[model samples]
Target: MNTFPIIETERLILREATCKDADDMYSYLSDKEVVKHMGLEPYQTSTDVLEEINWYQSIRKEGTGIRWGITLKGKDVVIGSCGFLNMQPRHYRTEIGFELSKLYWGKGIAKEALNAVMSYGYKHFELERIEALIEPLNSASQRLVEKQGFTKEGILRHYEYTCGKFDDLYMYSMLKAEFELG
Candidate 1:
């Protein structure tokens, strides 16, 4: 959309990431454990985080995708991010992705925010499909998408070239007929 969407869930706020979120975003994103499966290197500086946030905004402006800064309902600090990228609206599809702070690990926050965003994307775009390409080693993400009604299509062996190496990714997808808010 021309304007960023702010989605609210039971205990979270999925809003636009601003320069204000640079520190909070940098904190979690810079953690090696957090970015391990994210296909991105651990950010080395706040400038890097801001540039990432800039990419988020640019994608939205270009009508290619959207990303949201994740925070607790009563808090202002960004603890994570989730969004659609590589959007192919004409094809009725988009890629989904998410990452959370190590400090918030094991909380159901990611799942909650994810469901809300999925619901929005389904209706907002009249989407026919939503795709998630996850690193084969990211078991948590595998479980999350499966629980949310996605079906694993297959492994795209060495499908993506990033971080100086080719990586196999598990392709999981939820068709429009299969989408149901959890």
Candidate 2:
């Protein structure tokens, strides 16, 4: 099993998601406003959040991906989740993704958590490229990645099926060299 290390920021902690975090995760995951642009529909119950949490744990154990629960430094509640997805060790690349509660939206919490995770990806995984796929309508997410120095590559038509339809997405990427330069 791979170890998931605790990552700390000035105001946040990125750590493993646990079953105990179900309620917190559900608070956001079940909110229509929060999951509007997400690939999955809003969860209907805390059990759904628990199942999602289990899935997150499974991927980490399988070494396929890593998801961290994002919490305020002094709080025990998780406000969001962020981490690498679809990690390809052979290609030295991975995709980054994050979702935060609407309550925390605009507070710079997501950026802080993602910065810590991205730094880990670059340093530990030695990733050549870190990519993000954002639904075209998710302006907040677009701005977040742009602020992190990810360059917009282009549109991927009908990129994913979600919420009963295919969604187009904008691809953003930051190469290892660019990350180092920035």
Candidate 3:
């Protein structure tokens, strides 16, 4: 099993998810506004969040992905989540995803969490690239990825089936070399 040690930044901590985080996870993920731009459906209840936690736990056991709960430096509350999804070890790449509580938006927590994960992917997992598939309308996310040194690769037309329809997505990527230089 892949054991993810807690990663700390100037104002946040990225750590492995646990069942104990179900309520906190639900508090953010279940909010429609928080997940509106994310492709996944808004969680309906705490049990829904628990199921996600269970799924992440299983993935961790298989050493296929790393999922983290985002918490502030002096707080135990989980304000968001960031992780590698659709990890392709043979390809040396993985899709990155994140969600934060609406209240935490604009606080730069997402960027901090993302940087920590990208560093982990490069230095520890030996990943060559990290990618994010984002909705074109999500300018906030686009700016975040750009600030982290991801470049616009291309647009995948009608790429993801989300929110009851096919949505076009912008593909953003950061290479290990690109991240190292920035």
> What's the TM for model 1?
0.96
Locate the minimum summed-lDDT window of 10 residues in model 3: 57-66
**Residue-level lDDT tens digits of model 2 in 108-156:** 9998988899899999888899999999999999999999999999999
**What TM-score fits each model?**
0.96, 0.97, 0.94
lDDT of 3 at 107: 81
lDDT of candidate model 2 versus the reference: 0.90
* Backbone clash count, each prediction separately: 0, 0, 0
Candidates 1 and 3 compared by TM-score, better number: 1
Please give, for residues 1-182, the per-residue lDDT of candidate 1 as tens digits.
45667898889999999998898999998999999998789999987898889999898998888999999988999999999999999999999999999898789888888888888999998888999999989999999899888999999999988899999999999988888643
Off by over 4 Å in 3: none
Writing each residue's lDDT as its tens digit, candidate 3 over 1-182 gives 43468899999988877888899899988888888898778898888888888877776777667788999988998889889888888999999989889999998789889999899889988999999999999999999999899999999999988778999999999999999999
Best by TM-score: 2
Q: Candidate 2 at 81: error in angstroms?
A: 0.5
Which residue pairs come into collision in candidate 2? none
Full-model lDDT, candidate 3: 0.88
lDDT of each: 0.90, 0.90, 0.88
- State each model's C-alpha RMSD to the native: 1.3, 1.0, 1.4
